[model samples]
Target: MLPNNKIPEHLRSWSVPWPLYMPTFATPPELQPGPGLDASVAAGWAEPAFFPAVNDWPQRQAAALIPFQVVGGRPRNPSGRTGYTGRRLGRWGENQAADPIVTTGAGADRRVLLIRRDDCGQWAIPGGMVDPGETVPAALVRELREETGVDLAGYRAQILTTTYVDDPRNTDESWVVSTVAHYRLPETSPATAGSDALEARWWPFADLDTLLVAVADGGGRLYAAHRRLLGLCGGGR
Candidate 1:
């Protein structure tokens, strides 16, 4: 329910390392994404290599897209626990969605389209959820319109590689979830509509960081996704 960008200390791996955090939780059930999820609850996959322990990970159902990480716990500080209070299991809701990285040309006057997130004051590509039954492509286009107000039926576009975005969300010491990600693109002269965004317009590459960006996750994956988009746009220095 809280803004994901402001990841809580406990829910964050930054709290502690995996070696100390992995042993803090009770055993959990296996949960995988798709088909078995209720409309309100969606499951995601776990890469076995993510865990240092040899236990079987349960398929999980998270409310949204979030990354899960193994982190160590604190003792006698804020919560005033004695010692080793078991590991903290944490992750974000794994939201599966397509990011439509629409770009215009990069001539001296070129620019890329972006949407301002009123919630966090961050800039994010026009993207949203993958509605059930609708293919990714359609969902991408539809979400672009809903979020950034762009429709590309008659525009030139390309579907980039499929990617996964993991943003850590929960801190129950009993559950975790990892979200998946994808990308789509349509080239145009930076056009956008819809009141969902604080403002939508063409942004020069040089001023990208100045904008408050609110994409799903962080780390190299997030940076790399934008980098790949720049590569697709072909005007980065």
Candidate 2:
């Protein structure tokens, strides 16, 4: 557990973000310790067979190398202070996801596929969480098909990067990490929004920098972490 004096003053009094989906058993008062091991053990979400034990620092590091510390038997955020204690995310520790960067055309004509997220109503990469027991590649293909109705089976696919995502939904105990895969198609393919996407379409690669700048300036419609992910693809230069 982190020493009381070591916790930032502001965070020491921070309230947990109460999402409706969180179980009542897991809820706790502001600044109090998170759910206990008995609760997690009963919920079956913290089984060491599937997830790293709360105190298994070495195993957790080996899994994602995120450097999260154990605090009160829960994983503490390594990045810094957050507004919450217990997680709004479904699981404890690293919650893995996959981002599929589907693109068509070349040079100045390049275009990349994007989906309007239903939750935030912002344009983002067509991606979603990797289900338990699923491979990152499989999750990438599945998320692409589910969100944009695009099949990447025959496309030339390459893994671009795997890193921690600074998602807003992150809490002190849980955060997101993702694997980005780039898929290049021969030509523009038919796409329709499905699943959690409100709309899906291709956007000019040349406009990415502008859109990203708009986001930085607080006037853009792109998802924040996605902008960083897109920039890492080595496209739209």
Candidate 3:
């Protein structure tokens, strides 16, 4: 469901900034070799099966070889620390994306449901990229179902916010992902759906840290979630 050509402007900010698309010898933070580098980094688990693409590029652009990089057995930005150098084509390679932060939790007496990413096996809010053409909300719901098998029929999600997480592989490029978290009665959540999640389950609000996986900005999003929830509880009046 990828969009035809109109790149989503909202997603651009969610990726690595244009100026910081360089190696550590040049960029800041340089993606430290710590918890963020080890588990927080979103691994590209997209194989031909998950992400199907037409093979007409080679023939359509016959003699065109873009300057890019080939890292982690995948093509990347040539100037990227990953050393991906190939012909450049589109202004933004693959732009615009979305994610689903479907959570079920309450306050001191509440619990939050989470899953273990099969690829990384780390607990994370279920999410994925928003396809082209599909509306952000629709994509959010689709991804949520695909990953967890839970239904969001009654949850008309509003934008919680947008975030940009760092990508170590493409120090020259960025992975932009928009997240949509839908709240519901804990009983209706996938953790209770039985046949859904990989290992669908919930945790006490005080136990969120046990997972150790960071959200956008390395735990920044997690804090944001709590703060926003607090405002709602106070009636934000």
Residues 1-237 of candidate 2: C-alpha lDDT, one tens digit per residue: 211123345443325433432212222332223556456546544433223445565676677635666665667666655545565455677788899999889988889999888877778899998877888888899999999999988666788888888776676667788888898898888999999999888888888767655654333477877877888775432
> What residue runs in model 1 are displaced by over 4 Å at the alpha carbon?
1-19, 22-93, 166-195, 209-237
At residue 193, candidate 2 shows an lDDT of 93
If ranked by lDDT, best first, what sequence of candidates would result? 2, 1, 3
Question: Residues 174-228, candidate 3, lDDT per residue (tens digit)?
Answer: 3333444445555634443222234555555555653334453222223222333
TM-score of each: 0.48, 0.71, 0.48
Clash number for each model: 28, 0, 21
Candidate 3 — which residues are off by over 4 angstroms?
1-95, 167-170, 186-197, 213-237
lDDT against the true structure, each candidate: 0.43, 0.71, 0.40
Better of 1 and 2 by lDDT: 2
Question: Taking the tens digit of each residue's C-alpha lDDT, what string does model 1 give over 120-168?
Answer: 4455566655654567677767877776666667654466555443212
In terms of lDDT, the poorest run of 10 residues in model 2 is 22-31
* Pick by lDDT: 1 or 3, better one: 1
Lowest summed lDDT over 10 consecutive residues: which window, candidate 3?
83-92
Supply candidate 1's per-residue lDDT for 165: 34
